[model samples]
Target: MCGITGFVDFTPASEEREVLIDTMTATMHRRGPDDQRTWLDRHVALGVRRLSVVDLVGGVQPMVAQRPGEPPVTLAYTGEVFNCDELRAELRSHGHTFTTSSDTEVVLASYLQWGAACAERLLGMFAFAVWDGRTDEVHLIRDRFGIYPMYYTEVPGGFVFGSALMALLKHPAVEPVVDTEGLRAIVDFVKAPENGIFAGVKEVRGGTIVRFGRNGLSVTTYWAPPARPHEDDLDTTVGTVRELLEDSVRRQLHSDVPLGVFLSGGLDSSALLALAARHNGGETLRTYSIDFAGHDKNFTPDEVRSTPDYPFVARMVEHLGTDHTRVVVSPEELMDPEVRREVLLARDIPTSLGDLDTSYLLLARRFRQDCTVALGGEGADELFGGYHWFLEDRFVDAQALPWLEFGRQMAGKNGLRNTGLINQDLVESLGSDEAERDLYATEVAKIERLPGESDVDRKIRTVTYLNLTGYLRIILDRKDRIGMAVSLEGRVPFLDHRLVEYVYNVPWAMKSFDGREKSLLRAAVRDLLPPSVLYRKKAGYPPIDDPGYDRALRAMVTELLADGSAPIQPFLDLGTAKSYLADPTSAASREKVNRFSLEMVLYLNEWLATYDARLAI
Candidate 1:
């Protein structure tokens, strides 16, 4: 894992290029604390901050490959390619000699052997930029599922690209600006594909390749979930899922540094831990979970999260007999202004899930102390039907994104709306409602339907596609950014493209065969987990329910409203915010609605001030 940044400019000065690239690379110090390097030429500059996960001593960047009488091809890469060994063996047979055992070298070799088509052959989570001097072109590629992020924008002579938005923002050519479309994306939860949330900057969509050359920039999608007939019986399909999942987990276990699993005791994480334990040849595996300091006592059941993870976590720990540690975070830590600032910086935008983001950031920080790489269970919920919206009829039949509709319904129960606190005039001016409808239509149109498919089947597939492409992107981004922020690499075995493709085409009836959330997943791993965990209901990532955290948010919002120079004040409805703050309800009693509103106000203010973000609208 690493942080990569660079540019391809026709007009370049060597000294200035080095300084500029160095500055951009420095912003990602947290992503790669092990090593930093820069490579420069007249027309291109490449930089990387290395975490040294695989081939600790041998892997270094920006790595270059050259053949006599030919210009060198330099690669600044991030994320891991699990099929590196296989690709390396194949490349060797083609007379390619390698000096290092690094997957970075294997990626460069793949590019050399297949040119731009190399992205199609890769099987891992990655976003890499390859500068091919031979073709005088730079190719930016992201994994099929976009587990790794890549952002870029066109410059005067060429273009600049990076692993994170901050890297691109640090460049002199880019400005800290958020236009109307960007603002819409922030307020709306449906993340449009390739929307970078900054004017002129575009994210390299997953399963895509962006090539910049003399002719100009071009994008080609190398992969998407292809719709096909499902001919296998229920038993055969279950067996196939198990086989693909096991292969993915085994492939991701190849890491040089200490590795572990993020165990939430939920179906996703527990299943991964079970597989990891089985594959380790009886070697003890380290697992970790996160919880609030007083969660067990203060925890209140809601529609989303019904139970505390600790009980199930304990069961898994004892069942697997694996070494486990639970990181307990206090309300004070979650409410710390400095911690919030770091979370905002890590995300590069304000998120509505306040404590959810902070808790993950804190957990990643602690995880980094012991392990460089940790396997997670992220894509399982989206691939299998795990969310409440997937099971409930009202949500399933909703015309909009099922998750968005579910969010609205949940908030409505508290007499609140997702964006209720925002300025009404601003929302209309930004066309938030229209943008969401358009986005939904655009996404739904992208789903390839099977011939003779029933309306119910098509609707199910549409919802599944939306979740995989839209909601899953948010989950992956959060996991990647938070983990990378602490120099901890998070590997998601469930996100393997092979697994995603196979499961995506399975009929919904078979997916929910047992009439429960994640039925297919539970059936596949039934023997691996205790019934206590395998039968547990779907619970969202835990958030601190302590009133102290809510009190802190109220205090921060109060301070923001009082400050005459606060940037977010212009976009907020102060009267509504002040009324909410003045309400007599106890913080814990009114936690759901109040906490979300206050978090948005506080996070937006911090983001604007820290990033010097100007709202162009």
Candidate 2:
């Protein structure tokens, strides 16, 4: 794994070039502490900070490939390509000679043969910028799932790209201002929309790439999840999903350093731990779990004594004899100003408020002590038939319908909020029906619109696929930032396209079985996990019980309200901000700091204040 940054401009000044690359690469010190490199030129400058994972002694960057007499292809990459062996074999047959067994080399070889299009063929979590000195062009690409994030900003004369927003911020040319529209996206509870945190900054949007050449810049899609037919039966689908997951796990297991998995006592992470246990062959696979010190009440629904996954975590750890570390963090720690600030700094952008984010911080902070690379069970629910609301709610009842009463309820519920920091933003996002409309349009564009098909089926396909595009992106990207912030490389076995493809084709009934969700998954490897853990109702990642996370968030908002330096203060009234946070449950209140809505305001406030951002275009 590594941190990459560079600039592609009409021309370059040596001082400006060095300063920009230095700023970008230094921001990711934790991500790649071992070594650093740079390739500077008149028009293109690339820098890399690397953590030696695969090529312990050999993997270095910016890596270049020249076949005896060809102009070089220089690459700075972040993330792992799980299918490097397969790519190597394919490239070998195509007359490529490798200098290293590293995936970076495989990528360079792919570029040698396929040129910029090599990105489309890669199967891994990655974001890379390949500078082809020969063509005097730069190609930037992100993985299909966006497992690795790539953020970039376009200035008057050039475009700057980096693995972290902080890197881009290091360059004086690139402003670190927060994007108000981005705040609106979050306040609308449409967090993680196409927009990123910084105003002028944006993301590559997974499954897409950008090619910067003399002809100027062009962006295009190189890959997307297939929305097509299933040629397999239930039994075959189950078996295939199982096999693919194992293969993905096997590939992720390739690391020069010792590796481990974060055991959250959830289906996703547990499944990985089970497979990893088998892979380790009785060797202690180091494991980490995040537990709240005082908020044990978070799991009260399952009966503290009876929660299947919790006991099962211990069981699995014992079964594998892992050097298990259960890190217990406090509600106080979760809200600690310094810890939170450290995390936000690493985020390169503000994260949504409350437990989901902080719980990850608890785990990732603990992970820093044990292993640099850890596997976690993520992406299964999206790829497979999971999520309580999706299974039991109107999403299915309305016949796979797009926004049923449930989605409308969500919009209405959020609409009812007082909207303190982002009342204006919330209203603006609601005004634009584009995001939801786009989902509907996407469904119609992809699915068959025959005369007789039930709207329910269409709705099911629509919400599931739309979520596959949207909600899934939010969570997976969240996992990426949270994990990487601690300089930890997290691998998701469930995101393996081979496995996701199998689950996508399997009927919901097979996966859920008798009105269940993820049943097919449970049945596939019943022997791997204990029956108690196998049948446990999905609780997902442990959440912080500080429901008042928003209250603390409000403190930040109040500070911003008094601090004129904040961009949105001019647009907001003090009464509106207080009302939104003080009494959100009431329709008459202003800020409406519920879990999701409050998060938006907190995100916006932190972003604006942190970066000294402005709102006006």
Candidate 3:
């Protein structure tokens, strides 16, 4: 994994523009700490930071590919292309000879052989830019699932894009401004498609290509999971899922450096670890888990997380007999200002689950000490119906995105703290409710219902689509940003396009055939995992449950409130803010609702100050 950033210039390049590109690329140095390179042309300049996962010495970029008497194509790429060897062989047969063993070369060569359609032939989590000198155009492409992020902003001469928003913000022409809709997106959890949250900046939708030329830029969808009728029965679906998972794990294990698994002992991660171990045969695959200090003694069952992860993690670790390390974080570590600031900077957004994200960052940073890549279980929930919303009719049948429904329900229970505290008139003006409805409605409208499908099946398909495109993107982005922040490449075998496509068309009856969550998945991997893990109810990553952490948050928020000149104060209700700050660390104030409010205020303040954001709202 690496970072790619560049811009297509309608105007000629100069020394100043080169400096701007250098600054933009420097912001992503942590993403590609191994090597840094830039390629400049009269109308385009491309930059990349290399983590050196594949073709360590020869895979340098921005790589240029050409043939005799033909204009050259320069490629600035990130992420691994799992099938690059296959693509390379195919290109070789077509008289394209490679000078290097890097997939970066394959990407450039593939484009030379097949044009922009080459993106459809490649498979992996990638965000790349191809400058085709033949046509004097640049093509920006992201993986089908949007596992890699690509943010772009239209500027005076042309457009600028990068793997992260910070890179684009490094450009002098880009503004750190947010409008009403952007603010609503910040507070709300809706993963609006193509929404970048910054004024005039847009994220390239996954599975698509954006081409910039003399006629300006045009977007095209090169790939998407096809909607088709399911012909396979339950037994076949289970077998196929197992087969695809095995293949995905085997393919993803092609890292040159040491790799490990993020094991929580839940069905998803447990199954992935078992498969990875199976691929290794005799070798014990290293595994890692995250836990809170004193969690075993102070653990409390919650609606989302029933039991602590340590027990399940222990069982899996002991059963697998692999080299394992447990990262136990104390409340102090979770609430550390420096840790929180790193998390904020990594996400480049004010996420509601601040502590959990920070913990993941710590875990990732730790993993980097021993491994450059780690396989994580992320896309399984969206594809396998593992979330609570999948089992409940209310959320499944809700007209909005099911997770947003879950969020609202949690907000009602003080799960989303910032709900009523913010400016209601502003929230309403941003059409928070209507925005979610319209987005969900648009996604639902795009679902291609199968012939003779029942209402329940149709509903399941709609929810599945939203989960795959919306919820899964959130998880993927979180993992990418947090993991890449430490220069660790996080691979999701569960997100391999084949697995997602296969499971997406599976009938709802078959998915929940056993009247349990991820029934098909459980059946597929039950042979490898113990019954305890196989039957473990769905549990998300544990949050900071220590009251000491709450107290720390209160102190921080209180300090911010005391600073009347704080950037966020203008948007906050003083009385409400002070009231929450008064005793926000109490046990009664531990709900996600209160915590979200506290975290959001702090994040908003920091974000406004860090970016010097101009909020048009």
Candidate 4:
């Protein structure tokens, strides 16, 4: 919902330091175009770019609270604490009077009341910094789901933290250095916790607090998916899941600004729309969906995406009688250089899925024109065993992470991105396969299995954990980065900590009780949705099937071949790159490997030049 950047300097503060903080905040201008402000003290400097979602006129920051005798507590926060009204009431009862009707003040008072443990009592997707002038320390907290991103780097005097990696890179104290581990992380697609992809930088893990001050930094994990025994029957579990979901949707709908729901007509999105509509009562419900220009006419089934989204979206729109708008993107828009660059800027890294990432950015930007907040259906697949890999026998039995196994399957079919495209020497040096193996093992070891669990149950639980902890982060990060790029606040009720925890411990058997994906979710909201939508096979966000997009990508990558000094040349195998680009008119779904390879080459070259990145390896 907003962008936050700040620093704590153990050394003396100078005019240059203040300017650096300003520059850092400036990088996230698009994230918070509504307003900008800065706060400075002897050792701490905080900045915020606000989007003005709730209490728009009142919740301006960096908000500083000073009690009669206590040091001023300054807060630079990003995100809507969905439970603000309740928290404000409780804090008010405890003698905390609010001057502004804003959640930001409630958060500051919460810190004043509970100290570092304040993070434990909050609910919502947020990444914030609470500067306690009393203790001369700052507490950095990310939500339980890590929905909002917070990256930090330790500098000479103290540290620099920001909402995006680019925000941190804007400071002169940081450099674009990718070490071997960072490269491995980029290639492997396994989002290891706190793996920031740059040397000397780390992300604050979800449900954790990082305390930094003159004493140095300490991290404490306040929440995680607890491995608990299943204590309820199928019906009770279903009822409980439905109850939690309704509560989450009701809470998330507490937005003062105009809001909408993304309607893909998939189970997750439809259910969210249904629940949100119910919460809206008789009020008008605005909805939006995205699709390619000729998607329905040119639809092609694939392992990842089977059907087009437009038809299903139409059904939901008509069924719900909601005001709906469909944004149909053409191939040219998908291949536009400026648009692609903005997408790359949103995510300060070479994204793995090129069109998937850029399309959402474009759609979010369009949606921002009408509304500031949009509730989306993410985290459901991971939480409810909705991915196809969860049902595949090979992946279910594979000792590795199921998603990794799925990637291997894609590679075997010559469909995986970057397959047969990268330099073999780089692969050997990074040892990506081995690194991935180790990472999978580390993640698996973290899953605490229940006593007397069956082997089948154990394997399913492991896959569930991997998806929630690993794959879920990647999706959520994309959602946050792209959504914030346009100042669009994206809320995911499926990711509410309580819901995730409850479904996490439910046995996979019940999750797929009807021999279908997301059976539990389908059953929970069956009455609210049409059968066509309620039982529709899951489909991913559709990719542009137009061959023109592939041709455009090839033209861009071919230019790289002519320019031998291209930044990505050192990382590419010239022969393979040339071979892939020879016939570049096939759609990505038909020729995934070649299309993705060319897209990656262009993105990699641009990313290197954009950041002037250095490869230590």
Which of 3 and 4 is ahead in TM-score? 3
**Which prediction has the highest lDDT against the true structure?**
1
Q: Model 4: per-residue lDDT, tens digit, 1-617?
A: 78999999988778787788888899899889989889999899999998888888889999998989888999999987878888989998999999888888888899889987888778888889988898999889998878999999899988889998888888788899999888777766755788888899999988889999989999998887788888999989989999999999999998888999998989999999999989996898999988888776767678877777877889998988999888888888888889889888888987657788778887888888888899999999988888878888888887776776776677312256664467878878887777778888988887877898888778888888888778888888889888877888899999888898889888878999999999999999988999899989998877777767777777877888889888888888877667667644445323445566666668778899998989898
lDDT head-to-head 1 vs 3, winner: 1
TM-score of each: 0.97, 0.88, 0.97, 0.96
Error of 1 at 300 (Å): 1.0
Write one digit per residue (lDDT tens) for candidate 1, span 435-494: 778888898888888999987778788888988888899899899888888889999999
Which residue pairs in candidate 1 have backbone atoms (N, alpha carbon, C) closer than 3 angstroms, thus clashing?
A: none
Taken over the whole model, the C-alpha lDDT of each candidate is: 0.87, 0.70, 0.84, 0.84
Total clashing pairs in model 3:
5
Model 4 lDDT, residue 171, Cα? 78
* lDDT of model number 3: 0.84
Candidate 2 residue-wise lDDT, 1-617, digit = tens: 78888888875465667776877788888778888888876687899988888978778899877657766778898889988988999989998888887889888888879987888788788889988878888888888778787888777677788888888887777775545455445444443434666677777877788877777778888765555556677778778878888888877888878788888676677788888877775677889887766555554443112352456678777766778888777667777776776667766666554556777777887887778898887778776666644676555554323322344444322232424345464366454355545545554475433344345444556556666666677677777777767778888778776676556655555666656667877877777887667777777565555555545655766676677766565556466667765666676552233454455555656666787665543
Report the Cα lDDT for residue 314, model 3.
91
Cα lDDT of candidate 1 equals 0.87
Clashing pairs counted in every model: 0, 15, 5, 0
The lowest-lDDT stretch of 10 consecutive residues in candidate 1 is: 411-420
Candidate 2 weakest lDDT stretch, 10 residues: 300-309
Q: Given candidate 2, what's the lDDT at residue 561?
A: 69
